[model samples]
Target: MATDDKTTSHPADPARPGSGDKPGSRAKRAMLGAWFGFFVDLFDIYLPTVALAPAIAYFIAPDLGATGIAITGGMIFTATLIGRPIGAAIFGRFADTVGRKRATIVAMNGAGIATLLMALLPGYHQLGVASVLLFVALRLVGGIFLGGEYTAANPLAMEAAPRHKRGLYSGIINTGFPLAYAAVSLITLLLLLVMPAQGVDSAYAQWGWRIPFVIGAVLAFVLVAYYRRSVDESELFTKQKGTKTPIKTLFSGRNLSAFLQVFALMTGFWLSLQPVAAVLPTLLGADGIGMSSQATTLLLVVAYLLLAAVDVAAAVLSQRIGRRTFLVYAGAVMATVATTVYFLLVRFGPGNPRLAVVCTVLVVIVVVCPWAVLPAYINERFPTSVRASGYGLAYSLAVIVPSFYAFYQAGLGFVMPFNYTGIVLLGVGALTIVGAALAGPETKDIDFRAHADVSA
Candidate 1:
């Protein structure tokens, strides 16, 4: 359907450029398919951030209070992140054993179903705590599927892309995550615009948030079809079809450091990136800023767009300077800018909306670049045999703590302004990432075509 040949392997290998049976077109299809699938997957992931507070408050309102709502929201996200590593371990194995295309289709379908179920879930008023439990359960399911997505899709894309252009392509494709967030922010903002301004919270909880989940669910299914029709198995993976025990291979002494380095990178990257991307909306709604939901959504939409642009630029530049150098510098810059902007937002954000928006745009630009180059960088670290599982497991495990950043910020809010809490978290995370990247090797010039039996 997409001029992709399922029966034969393509020329572009995930690890290195090679002369294969076909032209570079297969790689193009993989990149496009991976990009779209991730767009839908990440859109579903961040949509909850926009809806979580209002939706949970609707359930546990008077009895649970703000503290209760905050705890519940944090638990839901935590469950989602926790489930991801489990999914990655399982699905990454599948990606290695069966094929990337099979894993991708299964993961997408599971995520779509989980999201659709969330849309149909009864409120806390009707089912009481049972509603909350079911919601958490479904989110966990979604997390598993979403976790599997990165393992298969990112490797497929990277392996398909030309070695010389990996940095640029990696950045462009990974932009899906931020762009999806921007899309959700825009949709939420539009819904707020059309609805009556009065009783906004009540209206949003009642039905407004569900609109986005419904859209995400539909989008996921569409991507499933698109991928099924267009995506072919990775050429590099195809050559390694008979490799024994992918998970086992990953833990071999020679490959151990590669795993560890990626783990550190993923941990540092998510720790730094999640607070700004996921927690900023809640932070804005807190007492210090007290911005309305509509205003926050508008701010995030603009900020996410800026983040996407900055990520692309950073990704392309990584090609010239090398991934390690780019990440180290980016993380350091984000730390300085985020720490400074936290104060800026606190001093002027409440009284000056335009200034807050401008500062937010700048903050996102710095904080988001580290994530842009990770897919290609991580992909380059391992051979095709264990690439999916190694990358997925590291990526999923690294996010475990950051997933709870919202809850941590909420508690810290009592002792300090939430903005300061975010800044501290961002600063720490940026430094951690920079330190890890500094220790890790540059992946830009690595020969992916060679066996990844030894750590660089």
Candidate 2:
């Protein structure tokens, strides 16, 4: 409700109380709230990665050892992926129909509760097959909400941002993912350092893994409070709501073309980025890539920090050069370089954790830049009349397709040591580059009230 109040004023327009022309203190606050929500969402989603081994050892296999551990970890990721589409669709619709502010609050609270339940879950030893089934169910629930967090938050930030600085503002929102990853990486490193290898299995299986989830839950509550205190519903949405046109009307004609373009961009972006950035650390660490758990965790933390920094840089650059141009160039570069980076990693092995760290960081920098531009790009694609709904539908479609990526990549041998993740990366990167060139439109200096036809 408070968010709705905030959304009604156009901060940049002099005629409006919070017009776009005014200083963007309110928009900044909204961005902070959105960023915080995304931070907790990501941290909770990735918690299981650091704790996978311990969980598998305790619950999946006391005897089969590494094989059992791998299988269990795979299953969890697979289950989480399957649940993502459901979250994306359900929450996306809510954001479009009800409002972004309400949708985000619901998602954050739901995901937090789900994470807490995961922390409280019984181990397989204590509960047998039921434990695994229950864990999957909890994660599924969490994933559903998690899917909607980005869809709502990204558009909200974009809708609230000044048009001139949309690229940088959108980049700031995208940075939350890497920043949260860095935090999780640091937390995992601390856990690994504090708990000896033998103790890790028992401690994490029994309880340690739950700590991050609980922390995530607490942070979620804080974000919800922040959103309630600060964020406003988008003025764009308010003006549109006064119109008689149904939100669904946006899906017809030229708007439908715009939706398809956004969806295609997202598919290519996620397919390339998620595998390298999101899933790689877990796969590498669990596969025993020649680094100690502590070493691997440290490497991942450093890589994530680098990624965050690069994301900021990319966002700034996009504002300067233009989102479409920047994305096209970055995607092209990533596609070109990914193969070389992957080869270097395989040739050297994780024997030197530093090599893996540097290579991974490079991959992230290349991959994330294009994605960092998406919030602004998607926001600019629709007029105020159907901005949230248009963005939600298109973005969710992109996410839903890429949700099963980990399973698909594993099946393709990208998860294998010295295998073809690099090649996959290159291929996906090239497709993204081509897609960006073909579909992306320049939004710099465009007025949202004027440029209603984005596909043109």
Candidate 3:
């Protein structure tokens, strides 16, 4: 069950090297390709966050109330999260029927084209109401394809990884997300340094945001080529590709428990993480932390780097111990350490850069690092026949709930005293996940090639 005992003998693995070849190198390449595909998908997803401020100023009419801008901003984010499920339904089916490689190629290209189109869209000044419509449409398109990328790439990577080291590979793949987030932040920080911040009217603020989208579009296309040329289809997938409906297959009685387990796990995972990931840096300044803009940016960069490192370490440790044990302990940490850190950061962040950094690091370690092994864990839950569809559906739906974390926090902020809303929500989310994890079976030693019955 441990790393040394599991077979590395997937002779039929499409990416497997021939006699006298370095098998490890080929597998590593495949993993890196999957990781990069995820990286680009996340980069495109986070673009809206970086663009939101400039977008609000440029795209909204001044006469409209704050509610109008808030609604618009919320819609922009909601549109993408909604579109992902739709994409998951479609591409998940496509991946099982056609091939993971083909589905990935199509999805990546679709996302890249949609992203490039965003760069060409007119702002409110040029297109008026049409601009908002176009923006939403483009975001929907990007979200759909990005969702497809997740469904396809994750299983491909998990199946490609050496069975014993799936956790390690999952950790590497998870790093793609935070790395892209950090990259976007770095890009935005640099742009803001030079761009004027003259509220709502600064030309650079309005147009400069487009530059990153353009770069993302280009990166997407490059990934399309790279994935097509470099990545291989999962041998497990190839062996089990079926002619039946994957979605329906997932809901059959035999697979229902696995589906529900993943759904709960994904829900708790995303709901707990998004608030901290999206709000922590903003909270630093809002809490009256005396950190300068330069200091804030540096802190965020360091935090993300630390997050990446923790992800790897946590993933490896999960393999050594057990997935269930690690998850249970991780849930405990999120419930206890992360919540306490958030409270301390909010209460004591004023004039304390060192304290702020320390608190942020603690939150990252507990709340974020444990998620690194999720791809592998989810993949382990189902057989190859419905793995992509099940993972995609569960992940997409789970993400939809968390997408509204902003609204949840806003509501909590209104009712809660002393701005402890975030800490409380984080605890609730972590406990929800912990409850779900307690119901799940330990899957660390599950054989990738073995499958459960598809029918009741």
Predicted structure with the largest TM-score when compared to the true one: 3
lDDT per residue for candidate 2 within 1-456, as digits (tens), equals 122322444434533312453444656766777678778777876787765445455555356566666676677877777666677667666776677788888988898888888878777678877887788788888877877777677777776666656777777777788888888777766775676436424565566666777888889888888888778876555554422342456668877777777778777776776657655565466463566556666676777677777776788788889877877777778677765676676667557766777776676667665667777878787765566566766665565566666566667774564355545745674576567556757765456645356665
Off by over 4 Å in 2: 1-24, 61-71, 197-201, 242-251, 278-289, 348-357, 399-418
- Clashing residue pairs in all predictions, respectively, total 3, 17, 0
User: What Cα-based lDDT does every candidate model obtain?
Assistant: 0.77, 0.68, 0.78
Q: TM-score rank, highest first?
A: 3, 1, 2
Q: What TM-score would candidate 3 get against the native?
A: 0.92
> What TM-score does candidate 1 get on C-alpha atoms?
0.88
TM-score of each: 0.88, 0.85, 0.92
lDDT of 3 by residue, 32-56 (tens): 7778888898888888876456556
Candidate 1 wrongly placed segments (more than 4 Å)? 1-24, 52-62, 196-208, 348-350, 406-418
Tens-digit lDDT string for candidate 1 (385-418): 8888888898888887776676777898899966
Clashes of 1: 3
Report per-prediction Cα RMSD to one decimal: 5.0, 4.8, 3.0
The 10-residue segment of model 2 with minimum total lDDT is 1-10
User: Of models 1 and 2, which has the larger lDDT?
Assistant: 1
